[model samples]
Target: MKPLKEVAMSYMALSEAQKKLEEGAFGEAAGESSKAMEFSKTMPPGETFDHDGFDALCYAVLASARAGLGEYDACLEASGRALHYFNRRGELQQDEGKQWIAVVFSRGVAFHETGVYDEALKNLNMAGEMITERKGELPGKEAMLKEIERRKSMLLEEEKSQRKPGYKAWWEFWS
Candidate 1:
């Protein structure tokens, strides 16, 4: 098992990556994110059966790191894993709807940024529905979902005109 100190160090690295990204240093961010991901991938689910929120949160961080690296598919995989971990433990409310929606919207944003409009729309639409359905019931999510979909619509025309040749081959490889 990894030591707690080591774990904290890795987490600090992840934070640094986030800061670099905020500073527009994408290369530095990607480097730090890669280091963080290494530790996270090796982290055990633990000896006993406890889907504590920590594991889910770790996956969330991984998803964020992947997003920073422009690895949209990787981000989606990590986010979905996070969501699954939380769902299995019925930690949705504790994790909050916004966190889950964040997983979806982040994937959508990644897809959109990568010019994969079809995937972007699918995820954003799902997020929109989730946000709308939970808005009245969930806390801290009244505006976020609305904003994400609005952003999606802004790219509608751009996506429509982006159908390049042989995209299907690359798409299937990713799929």
Candidate 2:
């Protein structure tokens, strides 16, 4: 196992990344999250803690940061990795469940920005369900729910506007 000091430092960096993200300093948040990920990589094999969940948290932070910077493709890629790690954990602990919400939300936004409306809406719906299910565990639950709804509405509006006003079916020919 890696030294306890190193593990502590990694968590500290992750904490800082979270703070920077909350402050809207996307670049700094990404840097800190990357640092945390690198530090965690140095950890010796067979550590007792949930390394996958930790890695997922780092990727989720990076995804959110990238999304804030308008780098949707990178955001989606990172979020996908985060989701992979999250799924690998199987049944989630309370903390991991909280992180999962953020991962899903960021992924949804990335998909929406990339014009993948179906996937975007699917993820947003998932996030909303997750938040609702974990309402007691999450702080600012009401605000998060509102934000999810707002994003869902935004996605729907965009999808509607982007659709071509053509026939609904192969048999339909009316204008």
- TM-score per prediction, in order, is 0.53, 0.83
Kindly give the stretch of ten consecutive residues in candidate 1 with the minimal lDDT sum: 47-56
Q: Write the per-residue lDDT of candidate 2 for residues 1-175, one digit (tens) a residue.
A: 4468779989999999999998999999999999998888787776666777788899989998999999999999999999997776734347767777888888888888888989989999998888877735675567767877898899878867777886275556554
lDDT of 1 by residue, 133-152 (tens): 66346543655566676768
| lDDT (C-alpha, whole model) for all candidates | 0.65, 0.84
CA RMSD (A), model 2: 3.2
Regions more than 4 Å wrong, model 1: 1-53, 68-73, 86-92, 135-143, 162-175
| Residue 62 of model 2, lDDT score | 95
Q: Residue 154 in model 2: shift from native, Å? A: 3.3
| CA RMSD of each candidate after superposition | 8.8, 3.2
Total clashing pairs for each candidate: 0, 0
- Sequence-dependent TM-score of model 1: 0.53
